[model samples]
Target: MRKGLFFLCLVLYAFSVTLTVFVQHIGIQDRLLKIVCTLGILLSFFAVLAMLFLAFSLKGGVESLEQKENPAEKIPSKEKYLEFAARSGLSRRETEIGWLVLNGLSNIQLAETLYISLATVKKHLTHIYEKTETSGRKEFAEKVMAFGF
Candidate 1:
């Protein structure tokens, strides 16, 4: 809904700019028309500034929400992760992949770090999920945190 309003405002501003140009071209020469035309041109800059403000503000808000959700200032050590993985019943390879996952590595990064293919990384993740009894990454992370990691 907010996005729709933003597009609507942009379209209206565009129309206003065109109207300003057309009136100025026809040589209306009215003082009020000149004032409105100048304001219309100035509004383009205002619109761009408003959009930049919204983008940064929205990103900051999302980051705050994410921090509230995770809030892990320091990651547990490798030994700690291994202990957790052992308790979770992860195999050797699964433990390695799960450790990277806990450390916030992407699948490609995990594959590169482990010298495995993407398919192999995914397979190990599947096994990790099964052993941890979690359906997905987010659930697995939550389970790990709940396990006092």
Candidate 2:
């Protein structure tokens, strides 16, 4: 799915670049038509740039996950985990969620533990993942363990 989106963006980007050159030379006199064409080309290019950015970010995230995976790594203790989360600049809720997540808690368990709804748990997890620079739970857990170790 990602690859298909990327390829589509690439094709559109290339077409937009080619269109820009050709459209400028054709000398269309209709002001509205010219504006629309220019806008379309620019938007296509922007979409392509966005896709490229996401692709690279996802690639980095996948690499990070792979690098952090180690069964031998130990889980972090409470005080140490909180300290690390503080250093990592997570919010109070995010730190709590991160700690629970690091302890191998399921999402439902996290919600129950924190007295939050499942949606709220997911929301906090997203924030925690972003602040911790991790892509998902497994990577985040490994990272926390690695940090403590």
lDDT of 1 by residue, 70-89 (tens): 53444566776778899988
Steric clash pairs (candidate 2)? none
Give the TM-score of each candidate: 0.50, 0.49
Candidates' C-alpha lDDT: 0.78, 0.81
Residue 142, candidate 2: Cα error in Å is 1.5
Evaluate model 1: give its TM-score.
0.50
- State the local distance difference test value for candidate 1: 0.78
lDDT tens per residue, model 2, 28-96? 777886886788688687977878787997799899989976543467678778888998899988887
After best superposition, candidate 1 residue 9: deviation in angstroms?
A: 28
